[model samples]
Target: MALRVAAELRRGQVVNLGIGLPTLVANYTPPDAGVIFHSENGILGYGPHAAEGEEDLDLINARGEHVTLPPGGAVVSHTDAFAMVRSGRLDVAVLGALQVSEKGDLANWMTPEKGIGSPGGALDMAAGAKRLIVITEHTNGGAPKVLKECSYPLTAAGRVDLIVTDLAVMEVTGDGLLLKEVAPGWSVESVRGLTGAPLRVSDGLKEMDFTLPQHPPVNKVYPSAAEAVADVPDGAVMLMDGFGGLGGMPHYLMLALRDQGAKGLTVVSNTVGIARVSGFGTPPSPDLQAVDHSILVERGQIRKAIATFPVSPSPSRPSAFERAYRRGEVELEVVSQGTLAERLRAGGSGVAAFYTPTGVGTVVAEGKEVREFNGRQHLLEEAIRGDFAFVRAHKADTLGNLVYRGTSRNFNLVMAAAAAVTIAEVDEIVEPGVLDPEAIVTPGIHVRRVVQRPAVFSPFQPIKPIEDNGRG
Candidate 1:
């Protein structure tokens, strides 16, 4: 059944395989198929399941089983992973279903009147994927799982595109359930007998093909953050990976760059930094600890910045980068968030430039060539590249294969690919074989160095409270 479903996958499609039998599709995928597997736990480009002792406890799929990662695979934050689903970036989503209606409604997350269930990412994937394919048994205990109307709560209304059961292959069309094929030896009447919904056989019904295709994991680790940034010279363009402040910003690496005193640097990032504030409570002292690129700007390391948000909104509490720009000490080039991501992706993928309508009719279109496409104007935006990128991850093997945790993976994944030299600051370092091959988000080929963060740098540490400076 898994092989049959896998055979339906086309090359260069981004697919998300649900738990159970759907997960087996990864194993049957041909090495040259170019199907990128996405796991809701925040990994893309994952390979097949691991065998025996090859499992890495820290590396697992959404099903919590060990898996392998492909060469150009990436890991992202949970939010970003779902963003890819909700934004219709996923080509196909193969899921298991409890019940499916003739109108293509899906009901797999939960049962009717039973509040006990985990929806996980089913609703998002079902509604957002370009194609939703359900793979399940034809019957459960002699009861048909397909139905005229789903008895269970709907995962998404009228979203299923295809349904592959153990007994038949069906497509959900506007007309109704169109039976395209059946399992070998099973008569059309036999499949119709098992289906609860009205089944119309295709005129050219054929046997479902299940021919299996034969299928077919670096280092870079650095010692300290200081040593990792030691080679970054002055006036070099650097890609700083982070979203907000807590999302995998290379905090220690930024501190090291401040100490390294590399002057006149160009930095590209989502934000420059937040403002400093005094510590709260008993001590009532100024909180001088720097967590983002603000420290670099404070030390006059950044001569220019290309980013979406360069300063905090409040004028009275300007960020360090803002202060420097106001004083004619730094250059700023603002860009739309979407364009920034595309630019970096293009840079890493070796695409020169692309046009988009995002910044049309705005100041962002200044000096850039505009092209008309389908009666709309789009500005040509060049790709962004960097000499070095400072990234953070949860775990890395000796070969610089990295796995990120939770929301920390945001921009780190993309920046790793866009930089000439990618330096990763991770919490833990393991042996090369200790990591599950499928769990690695950043392949070592993209990473030039890996630095392990000190054990004391806890991700969950409370933000320093600002001291009241009498104004409050």
Candidate 2:
């Protein structure tokens, strides 16, 4: 029989689909479904399942499954990804449920036993989507999945809108579960009997209207490169991913935020740039002056900066810099970049802490708790979380799935997986499903939103272009 549920999806709809059963809809969508698929990691514009022999090793879905890219697909960072979701940009999010309440609450992430890997960003998406459709097996190990109320840990208070199961498709109403369509070969009595929850039906109940008109999306575009920065919020922390200017600092945004009087930013990066390594008037340029973010950071604009190398290397870069360190001008926390990144990753993913051997010796072991494993000392690294992460990307789709083009992929992907919101800047946007499944490094699941950004030419004036400077 034809799939009744697939008809519920309309074209041009941005849909956030949970793992497993909900993913099947990607395959069943009509060629003209006009549906814009979203993966939580930050990919939008998803296409059909991947074809054999054409898999791009870099591409994969939220579940780490291979997928096809649709036409006009793009990749974005976690910041932009979550921004879309949190901003109420998605049309629908189809989720798989462990238990659903009559009130429409859902519990699909953690179970008493180990099942799925992690909830990832399902909770965020569930709470953010304009519409939520649940698709799941009718029962689990003989027990009905539907219940009068969810017994499992709740992800959101009350957000479910519809429940589609093998036995029937139901909508949540204030009165209770509104039975809409009974699956083929199933009678209303059979479905009612199967459900463990209190079920209700409208006297005027009828099969749901599944057919929807396909709407074409208006093409969206963005400037090549634009950066905007704001101060870390009160009671919030700031984090960055880089081993110094080896990866360029966030020059444009930092300046913007600085100008906005944004203060109390706690800067965290791999290391201080050349100023820390080279003395001023040194024969070779430390490559630090070219670093925009670091320059602003050194100007007392940043309240705190953390890195593996705390001491400025030359101890002699700028006369004032040496005096500042001696006088405690820039607060610093030294750590190995590896450990720091892992800590941030763990923190962002909700992991409490991880054990590593990178910083167990010498001064690195000062105040932190330490333990020995396999006859070697290890230090406990706590996780780090941030309100927003400014990450770079080559391309992103509307769904928020991100793909990095080159060295720029480094800390951006890790940061994408570790923030409340990630704003991704990319050079290009492609149709969904065009990226080879094997090529996707970051799945769309961790991503919340995406915006197409054009290419940026650097060293431009910060102020709006006044009278033409002939450089244009």
Candidate 3:
């Protein structure tokens, strides 16, 4: 079945193969065919499944299954990967379908009454791919899958172009289901009996061919957070994940970075640091409850900062970053939150620059080119890339596939894709196949190293006020 679909692919085409059987197309692709496989988890030009005993825990497809990489392959951030799909750069998208209507409506994300379904990248791919092809069995337990109208929720309307089932090949068109071919042993009459929708047999109908090919695995586990960040060098641009306060901050990695003693670093993140409680000033305490990038700032390791918030909300007690900026000890480039996200996404995705209206007509627009679109002014912002990105996650597999617990997922998802190397600090490390494929938020391919979060870091501890002795 996979070979039949692989035969349809052309040379030099960029394609996205969805989870499940659709991923098998990579293995069957002809060696001479210059096809590029893209995984929504943020990889392109990935090779077939790993050979036995060669699985790299840090390398896998979008489905969280281990895979190898082809020459010249690249990894990108989540937003950038979606940008590729939504920008119509993908030549074809082969996805598994639960049901495809005669009118070309697709329903593959979820079944009715099964709670809210995770759409993942299916919605964007359905609407963005230049061509969409579906692969699935002709029927589910003897029930027809090609239907008059999908009973399941639509992934995208009128988007399916072709479908390859166990028993037949069909093309979707405005006129309706056009039966193009049937399996070798199946006849038109047999196919019609299994189809819920009316069929239009093609004049050139023929038998579907069947042939198969072989393909091939890795695990990413580090003993400690310090060892995970040991390779990071001085004067590197580092991206830290966290929104406000310490909700999603990678404190362990930040601590490792501080202890690693890298100097002249440029930090990129949403905020400089959490506000200092009354007694938490001057010589910072390792037990300081609000530690974040501010710890780096206080240590004088940061030579510059690019962020949305670099000061404490209360002006009376400035953050370490604020004091550094006022002293001309560090450079600062403040950006809008949305713009910052897009910039990091763009940087990871091969996009040099883009225009957005978020920062127009303000200091954010200073020294940037402004263009008018739809009668509104927009500023051009270059993409922001990092030498390394430190992120936090709830759980991770030995292969580095990550699952976030809550708001901690925030920038961590995008930062994983935006860096040259991404080191994840996870609370727990499970074996491969333990985390559900659908639940894996950051795929292993985007991560270079995985470290277990330290036990000493307690989330519920209260920060004591800084001793007001003259240190203030």
Candidate 4:
């Protein structure tokens, strides 16, 4: 729960940590995250828990737990710490809650059985912080902690923005508590069964993943794309993101994958690619090289492709995959674009099959199950998962969170989530927390490795303009 909330932290944000589980967020934050830890006890810029004998008497958090002070950290006066919270300098405040209401009311300070609890700065932080994240168990002693209304005294009304628990992660939205993601071993039905209030499920609801390192992840930065994808084996299911151009394709990674000679691969993508005439969605810039699926197809490394645009729009201009298919060297499974996107999303969300009304009574539905949905036939599309995914991003942090440029953010986002191991090729990689959390399209949890594109390399030659040697 703490790690999930920690992912919400952005660079240069001052976060106030309430007592208990909320305090553990400090331990999960990346060492170089650049987040300033604020405690009501007057410590600022504190580090993780202190090692046994290295504990400093003066360096303790609001909970009185021994902690470490990073360089440039300072001990402030009690007045100043509370002043920071009251003045709304804290970007986020994570508080422990006894109970939260559907209306976003908090009830952590006092309960009838618990009696009057220590009020302690929580009320002020809850009201003053830019955003509030509440961490707690989904239930307390067989009773739901998330209630239709808080029976206990309120800490702050309509202040909580998010709720993180062992069972589920929810957002306090206008409709109600919106179920975002559920923990592993939990089902929506089971979570709803335990909640005191009605829950509104999000369309993008997925499993709350914990694949990231438990304690501040080890630096996953690799030196180059070659080393990053060196271990990719034969007969792998590879996911490549692009729209027949350079906008979002993992050019360097695909080059490395080709050089690595990992053959007999099945590829999932939006297009099989027209390499010779492809650019960043422009009219094939001569200065830009298109190192997309065509490279892998030309190398004969791809055994098959699952794509929407498997062939070029013009029959005269055949893609490499199309030519290969003509020669019986490659296979194709055509799907509608929307179904393809949903199929990848289902793979990441652990759904085996979903019904869609696309391709009915057509060749696309030839071998699939057909069902009736509201008097319309829907085909059952099985989810597509990948052994490896090669994705491109404009920038990446050491932790592997990514920010894409322009239409480059297309299939890359869903492909990253659907793959077993995702390798990202980026132009720049910064230290953790260097990026705005909102700008990150692909979280580091889904990315296994980060490799920087070579600083100096020309993949395409500039085409010379044709001179008018004859009359038009």
Q: Indicate which candidate wins on TM-score.
A: 2
My TM-score estimates for the predictions, one after another, are: 0.52, 0.60, 0.56, 0.55
lDDT of 3: 0.80
Model 1 Cα lDDT, one tens digit per residue, 1-472? 8888998887656799987778888878875676778888887777777789899776678899898765556666676566557544577999999999899998998876777798988988898788999999999999999999998888999999999999999999998999998999999999999999999899989888786544331225666888889888889999995876556788778777877778789999988875232111112233335466766777677899999978776677777788888899999999998899888877665567999999899999999999999999999999898999898888887656688999888888878878878899888988755776556777554577888888787323234443332311
Deviation in Å, model 4, residue 324 alpha carbon:
1.5
- Least lDDT summed over 10 consecutive residues: which range in candidate 2? 463-472
* Deviating ranges (above 4 Å) for candidate 4: 1-217, 277-289, 457-472
Model 2's number of clashes is 69
lDDT (CA) for every model shown? 0.79, 0.64, 0.80, 0.80
Better of 2 and 4 by TM-score: 2
* lDDT of candidate 2 at residue 188, scale 0 to 100: 82
Instruction: Tell how far residue 282 is off in model 3, in angstroms.
Output: 15
lDDT of 2 by residue, 78-97 (tens): 66566567655577888888
Return the clash pairs for model 4, or none.
Answer: none
- True lDDT of residue 6, candidate 4: 87
